[model samples]
Target: MLPSVVLMSALAVGALGANTTYTYTFPAGFNIGLVKSDELSSWCQGQRNECPSICKGSTKQNTCEPSTLKFNCVCADGSVPDVSPYIQTVPFYVCEATYGQCIDAHPNDAEGQRACKAAATCGSKNASAEDTTMSSTTTAASTTLAMATSTSASQTTSSVAAASATTNAAALFGLEGYSTGLMAGAMFFAARLFL
Candidate 1:
């Protein structure tokens, strides 16, 4: 019984260890499929220390002590680089590497604020700035996730609404057309929210 218990504990630890420090593969067409926030996160955790990257103003990796799936994106290349489906980067965030060491930014920085910001040991930026390149990269990645989620939700809602047009459309018609006016309004509102 004692041996069994020890074996169980060790097994559990191994699984946990794998998760704590693991790698995620961005396969050839990973960007094509649905956003793999989970996989990306794992990779980021191991790579630059950011994962499940975000799409705010800039991408950021969580640099907090005890990090979750956090990471910063390094510009794979210049030009209209595709972070992933629908997620295009006008400008890419190069890894937060100026000389050699990572930017030891303070908590005040917008990009520096994210505890999970990774891939950057820290940069020369003295933590007074607003955002970092990693911030942009992570933001772009996160935006991709958000857009994917939004698109999925929209598709689902549209599909359901299409069937319920007779009733919902009638009810909403009293206020505003659910499919046209209402949805359009909602979409605009969502755009603002994201923007």
Candidate 2:
């Protein structure tokens, strides 16, 4: 008697998902699908971390994990209530991917704004007038510093290039190999490697 009731519940949940285990059946020959919704819930909850990373967000469908025996849709409260096939119409603010059907919708709108706000995001500066002016000054200062750094780097590079050219000229002069420790090292390495 208890088993039959459990099977009935599975059937009911399976109706919502063509591939969902929420609604199921007790076909005489085989039991291809036998899931207790409550049990499924626990199983799904355990696999929550592995759900699609794309589902991360405030307006997220935080229901059963993708690992459910059969759950392709999320409930409003973030539950995987797979009464889908049995459900003829959609409730407000839900992405219609239940009942073996998949439909993506903005979890945002007039009614959804409250939820969105609760899921706050770090946004651009909503500064006061004085703060805005201060920010502009900081930005200007940063630009100036960047420019100064660029100029300093260019100057250093040019000086280094010029010094390198001078050293190359000394090298070409026949006394070229005498100026630095590198010359001695190169000669040693060359003799060792070649010989």
Candidate 3:
């Protein structure tokens, strides 16, 4: 019975530490209504192909269900991809791809062309705005750190230690999702023994 319990606990931890799925949605102002239902799957596939180019990882298991508006990418190795670059450019890429698709589907439809063009422009502007916002946030964080450094030595030291500890704890907990699973397993085993 003890061996079986231990095996279950280990299995639970393995399951918890498995692949993570990431969802990518069309940026705001993207007119999903403009895209035909049949075309969504193709668009998503294209986006999936674009993932490795944009993000810093492989995306072999990325998929998009037909008629769905989102793409799903699985992190097979339990390492979360750095999606900052992908996030910054996805809007523009999505818009451009939609526009290209629209053109391919209806070359002579002036109204469709205009709509697609407008959406593409909106996406471009959105990407630019996102870049600016991220820059501002980074600047603000740097300024805050500089300010903290100017505080009294003891207070600064304490604050830095607390911040470092919190960051380390969070990182450990987040890594491979193992810490959470281990804690839960330990609790389960303890409860079983008590019972």
Candidate 4:
């Protein structure tokens, strides 16, 4: 029984250590507007212009090109502006704004207009529901198991696993690297306790 518990704890810790990457793609109709060079540049420039104000002491330059539209304001220190608040509110303002411009520019193009409209509505959809659900499920299970074990070691291990699961889930939306060192430290401590 002790060996099984150790094995299970080790496996949980291993699972938490796995590196995962998440990519967020614009909704179907939104891509059409985003693909236009002029619109893309306009959006990119808007984000670039806001970088200095958003990410103080960061190099304010056009970091985004037509091919890659990364909207985050990356600082010289390799940190990015915390846009999580805006994400909760505006979601993809760049896509929405550019799509509006695309629709205006192609007034007579019905398909393009429809696509822009569809893109505009994407902000209302809960795209991260699946990721959130998965994270929550994992956290709940880990917590339950930890409570059942009724040991500080098990509880710590479970908390780390839950945190890792949550962080991995958040990574899908491009919010990463914030708690990496902290998680590693916690994992090391938990492992020591287990041993």
Score every model by TM-score. 0.20, 0.25, 0.32, 0.31
lDDT of 1 at 80: 16
* Model 4's TM-score against the true structure: 0.31
Candidate 3 local accuracy as lDDT? Answer: 0.54
* Each model's backbone clash number: 41, 15, 0, 0
Better of 2 and 3 by TM-score: 3
lDDT by residue for model 2 over 3-32, one digit each (tens)?
Answer: 111212122334454322334322222121
| lDDT winner between candidates 2 and 4 | 4
Query: Which residue pairs in model 4 clash with each other?
Result: none
lDDT of 4 by residue, 1-195 (tens): 111000011111232463222223443333443356775666566556555544444552325444445444444544444432232222255546557776877779999788676656423433245446767899999998977777877788899999999888888545346567668889999999999
Q: Model 1, range 2-115, lDDT digits (tens) per residue?
A: 110000111123323521221222221112123245543443333332212222223222221112322223222211112322111101122222111122434356564453
Ranking by lDDT: 3, 4, 2, 1
* TM-score of model number 1: 0.20
Off by over 4 Å in 4: 1-24, 33-35, 60-62, 84-93, 97-195
- Supply the TM-score for candidate 3: 0.32
| Alpha-carbon runs more than 4 Å astray in model 2 | 1-127, 175-195
Q: Decide which is better by TM-score, 1 or 3.
A: 3
When 1 and 4 are scored with TM-score, the better candidate is 4
Best by TM-score: 3
Residue 179, model 4: lDDT of 66
